[model samples]
Target: MPSANGDSTRNHLAVNPVFTAEPAHIPRNTLPGDGLAPDVAYQVVHDELMLDGNARLNLATFVTTWMEPTAEKLMAECFDKNMIDKDEYPRTATLEHRCTRMLGDLWHAPPADDVTGCSTTGSSEACMLAGLALKRRWQHARRAAGLPADRPNLVMGINVQVCWEKFANYFDVEPRLVPMQGERFHLDAEQAAAHCDENTIGVVAVLGSTFDGSYEPVADICAALDRLEAERGWNVPVHVDGASGAMVAPFCDPGLVWDFRLPRVASINTSGHKYGLVYPGVGWVVWRDAAALPEDLVFRVNYLGGDMPTFALNFSRPGAQVVAQYYTFLRLGFEGFRRVQQTCRDVATSLAERIGELGPFRLLTKGDELPVFVFALRDDVTGYSVFDVSAHLRESGWLVPAYTFPAHRTDLAVLRVVVRNGMTHDLADLFLDDLRLAVERLSRQAKPLRGAESASFAHGASAHHA
Candidate 1:
């Protein structure tokens, strides 16, 4: 029977005969008088989900689309546990603790028991926490010296994720976003320094920029901040939003001096679900040391039995993702992780190279940095826009995104592809064939056929969640 929710796959035969009196139409906006049988309810939701695009073929997102069967099983087992209830689920909490320790070491923070970190819902929450830490630390220093901490500001590239914008808005901090100028797509040493003032709380340097998947110059930005302190006595800390790069750079680009190896970096964050090779909704943030994060922000609760010190924006989230992260860490040690990331980087660079050879495309980034790349149509070959190709690819179940650049480069429109863990050489080869065909077919059009769907494409703060 068809339902008001528009689910036509509802089998009238209920899992239990007693529940056969299930209503003809499933109530969507209103609470149901009686629930449907388990099988019937499951079928109704499952069938509708089939309309979604193939996850394995989704090139628009940096999130992981696949994991091993064993990891999946482990996640299923831990779904019942609450991450916030540290006392009840001691082992789960321990795993979370261990992951932070590992990340601190990975980022090369000084060996100290007080270096604090926590897992959040994802990188967005992690960023917010890091921002709060930066703001609080700055406030404390100013107050101690009897200077008014009223006008706090944060500096970052225009390409930073939306979470940072939210932090500025919600917390009443002024955002000094360095705009993208001609030939400069992200925050550079000179631009970053120029944006800072005595009121600046901290500077954010993205380890992996969502706009083009290139790393902003964290080292240069830090050095620039150091110069600001020495020259003007304005000491500003740096926070690396390594949501994608934190996991990739360590294993792939071993010598990158973007982490705690730089003295001015106070904090760093990463999405465990992205390049960390786990499923969705797990993130980590590590402070250089306990001093970087103000003490008053942490809360200790004994209501759940043992007194636990916690710092997170979320409460009572499923512990499955954290458990999965621990399993991944144990399963793939240093060398194992190195191989997986290295393979992904190789696949991305190879795909980007072949994509550039497909006639009309010009590469903005080559995927060597973050296993991601952006490309745009050449000026001479202008029959259709990149959005036209994005819409075309969606018809074939691929979700490659197309959006224009921000600020000064708003004139430039392009398509971006994120090559994640499961993207194999075979899939890349298949995508190239599809892209070749798409380009050849679109060349026949006399003018642009930009669809209304193209209006939805946006980059930076508006579309950072993707």
Candidate 2:
């Protein structure tokens, strides 16, 4: 009924409506009757995220916060692909296998050709897989020796991440956590050896501890286990939780003997998303040899149109992170990784030195081994605690976490900072400036800073479980 021009006008009117002065607010708990425009929907969600702490200023998390544009493109391209479907995405599977082999070689696996490993959703899943293998291997050995495998246990420091506890609870293994004492923040060889028996599945040695970022003595633990084997006939293997240090120690400190070079370390798990310089949701676990991971734990499935050997806790996950990991490996190589890690270490060391000079703070760990450090307020400093400083630092959008030490050391509350790849020296300087200001403000306060008591209590509770 309309002319050509009128029809064109009508089509334009339908396609592009005038902006509404009062846009409908999005429902918080229910769906809307109509969908919003793409840009409006994006704006609404984006605006909400502005309340979050900037990832760049968050020194609390060990996760990687930045990546190359090319890696981002690669990740975006493969987000829809499922990592478990090997037949559909053969290249991704090949990349995953290559990454495993590379990590195995990096860890100095004895039989390079026979090395076995896999990609996990994250370090937690990787840890779970590693724990399962140890449990299964222990059970098989017990059955072979005509012994009971009912009372399996895992030995680790109280400083271990919560994932270890989850692994123990979810898989029916008793956690024999070694209590932390004064000046001894991690599991020692003597402590590890004393906790082992025939029922012990394995000892978990953290290369980079989550509590204070110190590398536990991996070699010493292994030697103690060796001695235990000779004296009591109980051979306990070791699994290194190298979440932050696996990619670090190899690149920064090449001479470290914490990996496959050690006879007792049967397996290791590292976060690809952490020091490996990839985004979140990628982890790697590698065994010293194929025999280290029991065959019963691996299940052969033909569901995705071909036979695939799946050993991960997660059935389907985004293959994008694995691709990003491979991209990083190719892009960085050994020298590039070393340079980045060394830079971070330098920054951490410099910060630690400066913080120690502040008079009111004492250095716990000086970022000597890993690119992370912890500091606590000097006991003489009254009124303001480390928690007050942590709270005040948030005013400048910095997220520095303050928490107490585990078990016997609950009284030792401290602040921790993780210097990751993107943390430039300039940003470090800014953080130091802000930290000094925060300390000065807290020092001048008449009474204990607000929330100081609650923060102390909360950290004490957390450390009780640590």
lDDT (CA) per prediction: 0.88, 0.87
**Runs with alpha carbons beyond 4 Å of true place in candidate 1:** 1-23, 303-307, 451-460, 463-466
TM-scores for every predicted model: 0.94, 0.93
Clashing pairs in 1: none
Q: Which tens-of-lDDT digit does each residue in 338-368 have in candidate 1?
A: 9988898899999999989888999999999
Quote the positional error of residue 6 for candidate 2 in Å: 52
Give the Å shift of residue 355 in candidate 1: 1.0
Model 2 lowest lDDT segment of ten: 7-16
Q: Considering every candidate listed, which one attains the maximal TM-score? A: 1
Per-prediction backbone clash count: 0, 0
